[model samples]
Target: MKRVFWRAGLALVIALAFSSIIYGTSTLKNMQEQKKAIQQQIKKEYEELKAKKDEISLVYQEILKYDQQYFEVQQVLDVLETRLTEKKTEIETTQAQLVTAKEKEDVYYKNTKERIKVMYEYGNTEYIAVLLESSNAMDFYNRLEYLNKVVEYDKTMLRRLEDIREEIEETEGRLIIEKAEMEHTQAEALIRKNDIENIRVLKSQQIAAANKKKEFIESEIKERQREEALLDKKIEEHIAAIERERQKQNNNALKFKEGFLKWPLPGHYRITSPFEKREDPFTHKIAMHNGTDIGAPNGTPIYAAADGEVIYAAWMNGYGNTIMIDHGKNSSGQHVITLYAHCSSLVATKGAQVVGGQTVVAKVGSTGRSTGNHLHFGLKIGGAWVDPMKNTKK
Candidate 1:
């Protein structure tokens, strides 16, 4: 009976051990799943933020292009004005010519009227009487020739006057048409001028809007930078905690993954500036670039790299709209912090535990001291700034 009791006790112990092992395996699996989910969430959020930023940037650029077009229209209007003035001068000259032609026509008509009246009153009777009253045949013949010559001369004068009148009328008609054309041209020029003024006003409004957008974006960027810095601090602390925990556990097989991380945005966005100590674009002086700048449109969505708590989600001075997340320690005891700067808004909040590939952040904008829309991602290690790309997983 004692021997039987011993065997039963040993079996119970084996059963307990098996149960413990199963429990530990399940817990580890759950943690890994959670971590993966967090990473995915971070990536998703990063993409969304980038998209928002890109959109805003595009709008600003469009506004600038419109301004250029507005100036061009103004130039065209100026040319139109000059053309109208020249056309007015031409019209005036045409009017004068028309008047002169009318005067000449009036004179010709008057002379023709006088000749016709004289010829009508005298009729053919005068010619016949002059011929009969001749002293001899030779004289009569000579007198007839002189009478015919006078009638022929009068006919010639009448024909010349008629031709002059017709020519004058034609010229006046042509001048009238030219004057009408000039008036139309003048009207068109006036319309063009009005259009140009309208365009200028519209462009001015656009410029103002762009400036306002830029201001907002800049403010947001500064804020993001601060948030990122804060997040970095938190992440470092978390990493250190993880390291301590790992050391206590003494797990020698676990290792942290390492490589340059891919940019959160999908498009092949350009890096206007790199992570390093460099000169400022506007200041043109030596300054430290706390983060790498990735150019994109405004209102683009931002994402997190791994699972962690959001330490900040607010406006930072130079980072514009920003988001900072802290990823907990890996098996190897390393902590990770990711910062997103120059955002239009913050979708996530402080103390919120976010998952990876989630839309926890927004796009980078020209919020503070920025020339355009772009993301400034910063990483930190042990309360010190580190290259983000270097720590990112491949």
Candidate 2:
């Protein structure tokens, strides 16, 4: 009975040790899988942000064009106003001519009427009587000639008055049309002037807003640089400590691997700028791009790509609003570290164990050496910089 009990106890101890090994392996695998997922998410978010940044930039350019157009429209309005004034003066002159013509026409008509009436009355009486009562043929002939001349002169005057009246009516009709055209032109000019003014105001406001945004981006970059510096210092110390602990525990067999991790953000983000040996966008000089630029908008959410412990969650130099996570160990015993820079804000705290696909960072404005709002993602393997794109598959 004593032998049997001892054997049972030994078997139980062996079973427990095997179980522990299996559980530990499973936990490590889960963490690796989580990290890969987070990396992919980060990449997606970066792509989305980049596209949006481009769109916003285009809008800014369009606003500038609109300003120029507004100025041109204002000039056109001025020309229209001058033309309208000239039309009004011309209309006034035409109206005066019409009034003068009408007055002359009325006077001519009154004189013609009186002359015709006298001729008609005298023709039956005194004119004819004088002709008939003449003492000689010469006297009668003279009176008849005088009467004929008078009648001819009166008929000419009446025809002249009729012509003048027609002319006055035609002139008045033309003046009325001219006046209507002037009023219409004036009204159209007023509308255009008002539209130009409104457009100018709107364009001015847009320019001001763009200027303000530029200023804010500059300030943010400076602050992010300072924070990144501090965070880098902390990260270095933390990695060193972790290395020491791993060696002491003889767990150096497991380590982080480069080119095997995934993105940390969601969405497809284009790398407007990349991490490489290239010319700087602002400086126009050859400089090392320390991190990859993934353009995004302000307030876009950021996620973790893998399961890892937050080693440093703070700002660093040249990296605005940064976060650093330490993925424990890979096959080579080297530590894996992921850095997120130029974030708007940090959601996870240092020492917190974050799961893959979890929101750990916030999208923010460009914080370092950046022209716009974007996130700079960096991957460091065993304290050495590595290309983040190499690890991304999709």
Task: Please give each candidate's TM-score.
Answer: 0.38, 0.41
- RMSD per prediction, one decimal? 29.9, 27.7
What tens-digit string does per-residue lDDT give for candidate 1 at 137-254? 9999999899778768767765765676566567557656765775676577567657655765665676566566656655665565555556556556655665554453233112
Encode model 2's per-residue lDDT on 1-394: one tens digit a residue: 2223223423432343234345545555554555455455545545554554565576667766765665676666677577667766765776676677667767877877776688687767767786898889998898899888887876787677677667767766776776677667667756765775676577567657655665565455555554555555655655555555445334322433445456665684778778687776666777666567787777777777556666666655556566776666566655556777777778888657676566555565677545787777776555566677886544
RMSD value for candidate 2:
27.7
> How far off is residue 169 in model 1, in Å?
3.1
Give the whole-model CA lDDT for all candidates, comma-separated.
Answer: 0.62, 0.63
Q: Model 2 has how many clashing residue pairs?
A: 50
- Badly placed stretches (over 4 Å) of model 2 are 1-76, 120-126, 129-150, 206-214, 235-394
